[model samples]
Target: MTERKPRKDAVRNREAVLAAADVLFTRCESPADVTMADIATAAGVGKGTLFRAFGDRTGLIRALYAARLEPVREAIEEGPPPLGPATPPLERVPALLDAVLCFKLDNRHLALALEGNGSDSPYRAEHYERWHTLLHDMLERIPGLTDSAFTAHALLAAVRADLVEHLAGHEGLPREEMRGHLASFAAALLGTRPRGG
Candidate 1:
């Protein structure tokens, strides 16, 4: 079925609301403290319009997070992946590492969490679950693993908050060096390496 076109004013109103929310999220320290009226006033829209545009604060957060995740999604689909029928599983390791770094850089909240060593929460655990699922699906050929899911979880643990802080902060290693070394270490364990960094 053909999609009906939305009216111009309706589109403008939604854009205004999202723009306002973006500003608030970037400027505010704690997202939980921000209110609907705060968003409405910032956007120059009515409180009712803010509520109508984004049902509630939770809906707003979900939309905000999803918007941030979009580029990461596109990067995964088109920027890097296994890449070829001939590209070995180990070759994908660096791509995976790079992807995770990109995601962390893109999300300010996530970056803050990383800085604060806040990777142990239930919220972060959910991200690990999704990351592990994706890794298991992509690195299916890694040997010594009857269970790829279990291995993925282990790998994520290796790169978790404190570990990452040690690697990038305390250890004084360059981010690219850490990525290459970690990918190589994993690839060595996997027994197959991808050709490119």
Candidate 2:
């Protein structure tokens, strides 16, 4: 039998709970400070429902990952708004890199949560594939890549999130410089004649 889904209000409450948890966890320097009850209060949902819906801390982390995914995917796959149709795809590339770095900087908590979860979830795989595929697509449009995938893979590794974060955060590189370097590096790897190249 087809089971009935939760009511619209219940779905909305679940979304709110996830969003509240996301904000709290992502912004907190110490993730241990976040609690289910705290998320429930912040989301304006009952504590019992929170527990029932998310089960526990790990559950909440998974929910946060799932909740955050759409926006991340959209930002990368679909150019962020305000840039609109005016920005050429190549021109928007550096902006996209900056947006990605900003997302990681803002949501370091979710990255921490994903640290332990292996390749079991489809989400992590999707994230990897999206970046790799996007890099491949960009490389193919380069008017050079006789072997686009190989060149694209190399470009992807260069600007991979961990490396970018290490350079920008730990190494104390300025964000603008990091973005510029990544864009330039990717163009070089693909042998693309970038605007400034």
Candidate 3:
């Protein structure tokens, strides 16, 4: 049998709910502050519809996070240099980390919500595993880098959402400065000098 597409209203409701959740996540003081009911109200849908569509708050958050992260994922998977598959491991590794750092910086609230959700460990999240695997594989391609697994984890830890929040939100570090610091750190581990450093 052929797969059936969703009805028009279902499609519309999903988009509306995602948009409302996006706004709520961006504006809320904390991730937990934005609830399913609030998103339903904002999207002009009922709470049952929201739950039926997403399963629960965590499900909704994951969907929104995935939607927002699609571009970055596409870049890494298929786009040009620094992030694409064709890039050299050394170049791609740092580029990937930088992308993660930048993404977390850009989506502070959503990143925090996804990472901070107590129902699951951030390290075990599907996105985190994908990043770690990609980074680990890249690290293995470099001539002298050892402990590719640990190195990948360590590099990722530097850009963890909470750490990003602390540096960007609490310590007030400038974006360029943070990027520079991360580049320098990644270079030190990879046994190369950061460009111009």
lDDT of each: 0.62, 0.65, 0.93
lDDT by residue for model 1 over 9-49, one digit each (tens)?
86788778777877776676654456788878887888887
TM-score of each: 0.63, 0.65, 0.97
* Clash number for each model: 3, 0, 0
Kindly report which residue stretches of model 3 are placed more than 4 angstroms away from their true locations once superposed. none
Better of 2 and 3 by lDDT: 3
Q: Pick the candidate with the highest TM-score.
A: 3
Winner by lDDT: 3
What TM-score would candidate 1 get against the native?
0.63
Off by over 4 Å in 2: 1-5, 30-98, 119-124, 193-197
The segments of candidate 1 whose C-alpha lies over 4 angstroms from its true place after superposition are 1-4, 80-87, 110-130, 156-197
**Window of ten residues with lowest summed lDDT in model 3:** 28-37
User: To one decimal, what is the Cα RMSD in angstroms of model 3 from the true structure?
Assistant: 0.9
Name every residue pair that clashes in candidate 1.
90-194, 91-193, 91-194
